[model samples]
Target: MPTPNPAALDFLQTRRSRPAKTLCAPVPDRATLEMLLTTAARTPDHGKLEPWRFIVLGKGAMPRLAKIAEERGQALDLEAEQIAKGRAQFDQGHLAVAVIEVQRPSPKIPALEQTYSAGAVCLALLNAALAAGWGANWLSGWPSHDRGFMQAALGLEDHERIAGLIHIGTETSAPPERPRPDISTITEWVET
Candidate 1:
């Protein structure tokens, strides 16, 4: 027999990400945000490499980041719409945690596992925020993928890259639930 956590399972099934644009003011305070980050840091890491870190972008940093996005977009010869789209997340974000994947020198553990661990941290942070009653969304736009943008915005090292930006804020509206994927289509079981 196996012990079951019905509530946790139910929450996972019902979890939905709120749109970044729809999140409003009164974001989580520093102490609260720290708790979420702590929860996120608990994600599994092979060999304890801990190849990730978090950069918390507060309200004051948004404008600067948005400007950087615009400048980077221009430098990259990106279209106007793409530039706006890149800037919009920062423009509307109250607070966001930039989950940075920091690749470490490891002979035993592969780099891909570190990346997967970083991604897991991002999701853990998002879920932590949501569970704490804050509306949250994980976003990564073209700017996040641009090396120049990463350097300009956060002074990331060559080995560091953005895994995600998990935005957390007050919920302005309850978004309607969207369709979910059927487990049968995505899951496979093997007995060998």
Candidate 2:
């Protein structure tokens, strides 16, 4: 007989994502973080190509990533605030995992599929952290889209790119619930 997991269902129904900027210190330890990474790795990958990877940037790597983000932002002529926002995830982060979308050359599996899989991994990581009693958020600012930043910060290869940065830590304050889309209006029924 299988045991019921009502808590899991309940949590899913009410789970909300805390903003990365609002997250603070006391991040999850290495062993605990590994659990979240393990959960994230289970994302759906078409043809088992596994066209994605993750870079766990703990406390030690934040300064380096921040420095690179600032430099890249300056080169792009971004405003001071814009540059700061790009580097905020690292500058104030306790822990983060960068989801990298790797496009593999495959005749069967399409590149879009790989991209979707990487996005799934990001969500998985965020949900896993929340489930583990840690506040988490998925963030992607200009740094995530900047090629120079990706190459320098995360050491991305030509075929790989940033999908998202999952920031996990304690919530400094509770996030107010925002309005959600009307599901009925968005859903379409298929009938012959």
Candidate 3:
């Protein structure tokens, strides 16, 4: 029989992402963040090709990125509300890890699998942060998707893109539980 880990199972069942705006200062220190990243890097890669990299954006970097977001939004002719929504994450972020999806040329593994690996890394990192007692939220906005904004703010290469920006900080308040999807409706059991 497989050994059961009730705590891990329980945590997964109850885990909730803290809102980025509700996250405050006192973000994880370098050592703690490093440990979390180490944990996140253990995500499954089909071809053993680590097709993701992390860029740690400290508090000092937020303002600079915020400015870039504002400029890029204006240049794109985005409405004020949309621009503000895009900039809000950076403006409020205490610390974030930018998960960059670096598409590696692989013969055995397809590009789509590599992209899936990158996405898994993002979720792993977010879960790792939350498990380590930090408030964490995964965010991607118009700025993250806009090529010009990405190039100016993060220097992403042609083969790389932003998978997610995981904001980590102390929780100012616990978010109330929201509605959850009905698993019965979403799940399908198959016997072939």
Candidate 4:
């Protein structure tokens, strides 16, 4: 026999990411955000490497990051529309958490595993925020992938990279449920 948490399972089944652009004000306070971060930190860490960290971006920091994104986009010779898209997330963000993947040297755990762990943290944080009744979305765009932007905007080291940027705020309107993947086609059964 196995113990079950129906509520948790139900929540997982119903979970859907809110669009970042649709997220508005009344973002979680520092205390509340801290609780969510703590929950996110509980994600599984192979070999106990804990190769991830969070950088909370408050509303006041949005403009600076947005500007950096614009500059980085231009420096990379990106199109005007691409530059706008690169900066849009920061321009419209109220609050966001940057989940950074920090690679630690380990003979036991591979770098890919560390990356997977970091991604897991991002999902955990997003889920934590949603479970707490906040509109949340995990995003990553050109800015996140640009080393120049990462250096100028976030001051990340060479070994650190953005796993995700999770935006959290009040929901202005409920999002329509999107189509889900067909699980049967993706699943496999193995027996020996």
Candidate 5:
């Protein structure tokens, strides 16, 4: 007999990520955010190597980051619209946690596994925020991938990369339910 957790399943099915642009004030406080972070940190780590970290951007830091994004875009000769796209999240962001993938050298655990762990952290954080009754969205822009941008914008080292920028705040509008993938087509039942 299957013991069904209706509440958990309902939440999983109904959950929708609010767009970063749609997130506004009433961001989670430090105590609440810390709880969410704690939940996120519970993600699996192969070889027990916690190859990731989080950098929470404070209240006033967002505007500065937005400016830096704009400057970096101009320096990289990106068009104005593209530069604006890079800066938009910061300009309107209420709160953001940057999931930093810290690659630790290991003979047994490959870097890909560590990368997967970092990605798992990102999802954990997103789900935690949503479960905590806050609107959250995971994001990664061109600036996250550009070495100069990551360094100047976030002071990331060579071994560290941005896994995600999770935006958390109150949602201004309810988002429509988007279509999901057909799981039967993707899943394979192997009973040998």
Candidate 6:
């Protein structure tokens, strides 16, 4: 029989993402963040390609990225609200990890699988931070998707894109539980 881990199951069941805006200072130090990143890097990679990498964005980098967001937003002619929404996280972030998806050529694993691996890394990092007693939220906005902004701010190459920017810091307040999807409505059991 498989060993049961009730505590792990409970934590997963109750896991909630802290809002990025609610995250505050006193973020994880380098050692702790390294541990979290190590945990996150254990995510499954079909081809052992390790198609994702992390970019640690300290508090000092936030304002710079926010400035880039502003310029890119203006260049794209984004509405004021849209631009603000995109820039808000960087403006307020204490610390974050940018999960970059670096697509690697693989014969057995397809590009879609590589993308999935990158996405999994994002969630893994987010969960790792939360599990380590830090408030964490996975976020992506227009700035993240903007090619020019990513290249200028993160020095990303053509094959690399921002999978997510995971904000991690102390939680100011616990957010109320939101409605969850009904498993019965979303699940389908098949026997063939």
RMSD of each: 0.8, 2.0, 0.7, 0.6, 1.3, 0.7
The sequence of per-residue lDDT tens digits that candidate 3 reaches over residues 12-62 is: 999999999999989999999999999999999877899999999999999
Best by lDDT: 4
Please, what is the whole-model Cα lDDT of each candidate in the order they appear? 0.95, 0.91, 0.94, 0.97, 0.93, 0.95
Candidate 5: which stretches are off by over 4 Å?
Answer: none
Model 6 stretches with alpha carbons more than 4 Å out = none
Instruction: Give the poorly placed runs of model 1, Cα more than 4 Å off.
Output: none
lDDT of 1 by residue, 55-135 (tens): 999999999999999999999899999999999999998899999999999999899999999999999999999989999
**Model 2, span 105-187: residue lDDT tens:** 99999899989999999998999999998999999989999999998888899899999999999998888888988999999
Q: lDDT tens digits, residues 15-124, model 4?
A: 99999999999999999999999999999999999999999999999999999999999899999999999999999999999999999999999999999999999999
Please write out the lDDT profile of model 5 over residues 31-51, one tens digit for every residue.
999999999999998999999
State TM-scores per candidate: 0.98, 0.94, 0.98, 0.99, 0.95, 0.98
Q: For model 5, how many clashes?
A: 0
Q: Is candidate 3 or candidate 5 better by lDDT?
A: 3
Give residue 40's lDDT in candidate 2 (0 to 100).
Answer: 85
